[model samples]
Target: MNQKQEIQEGLWDEEAAQTYDSNEGVFAPEVLRLTVDRLAALAGPGKALEFAIGTGRIGIPLAQRGVPVSGIEFSRPMVARLREKVDEARIPVVVGDMSEATAGEEGSYALVYLVFNTISNLLTQAEQVACFRNAARHLKPGGRFVIELWVPELRQLAPGLQAVAYQTTDEYFGIDRFDVVSQHVTSYHFHFGAGKEARLFRSPHRYIWPAELDLMAQLAGLELESRHSDWDGGEFTADSSSHVTVYRLPE
Candidate 1:
């Protein structure tokens, strides 16, 4: 495998891939439903290309919603799990890096979506910019490119602090350590089960600010259309934790 193929190796191993559908924190049905509704409406009768499709949590449902959906995913194990949900005919998946890969012809999809903060997986500003350009390349004129991302929440950080624990439960605890200079955050998830020792998983992400993402989109020939706090189109405010923003190619 090339270096790009190994990008998701340690994090997206078979064990983690298997747990995806069962993880309610990540795969809540209502979340997927709302996402599909919004993307389907934007897609209309045209096709969509999902970045990092990842077990089809969104792509499968979007395809089931009657919009043709294809995906570019880097993890083979995750794509294998997605294959169990839908066949290639229903949702064709290209196994490659979303930042640099294409599902088919360029300018073929009407909507290109990267949900669940997946763009952060790129791990660098340059990669994120390339991803935006790649998304724009796959869109037809006037097609939409949508992204869901968490706003950087650094207000909780005290001076000289580099890490914060944001989630705690009886069986789970989550923390993120930020590298201010690099704009990167490494998330650590700890899981405990009855009568079992704890397991920890570390996922590295490069978080981008909303304004930075807008500039990246602009560099890719896309114009910002709207920004919302959620799939329901609520207004985005300074206090909002996450956002769903849409950009469009010129007609």
Candidate 2:
């Protein structure tokens, strides 16, 4: 990847922070348990580092399971939300961009993970590659780097269609505006409630193909160790909407 492209950062304000935990699609117990269980198994007795560990979603639970977990997160509001559940002593976090931040000893973690499509928040291919390298830098030799991400569904976009309403429910409505040529999307989420005001959140992302992510890992000196369609190690096939992929540094 070219190293000179100007990177775009995300804005995680109070609204974004406050509503993060309300996403039942992700924050539901069963949803979180699978992720925590799988990560804990990979973590063994060693430490795990999280990139963009928003509100300690996975970090806190993983740490509680006896795997030391630290994190790098850029949003103050998000960090504040995390503090509500656990103090810094429980799941320590570094406040900076995950692509450029350090949270623990170099090459000291048994696993480094970025989940919930957080890698897409980097907004540029170069920064995404840097994030992979950062994960590698934080990993012990032969340690794992794992990520959860949605596969790009550009095929759903009809000609001249720049936007798609990917989700609509009684409580939530979500849409994504596509920049197909640029591999970027700006997602808009409108949330509803029972007799309460509607809430809106907007986030930008740069999508990457699985092959492109593999190349990034290769550049970071990490090799693809495994990939599954979900947290439970389901087979990855053409129809899967998302994937959990793990890579490893040379032992």
Worst 10 residues of 2 by lDDT: 1-10
Candidate 2 per-residue lDDT over residues 141-196, each given as its tens digit? 87999999999777788998999888999988999999988999999989888898
Best by lDDT: 1
Clashes of each: 0, 0
lDDT at position 180, candidate 2? 88
lDDT (Cα atoms) of all candidates against the true structure: 0.91, 0.89
Candidate 2 stretches greater than 4 Å from native: 1-10, 194-197
Tens-place lDDT digits, model 1, residues 81-141:
9999889999999998888998999998999999999999888788899999999999999
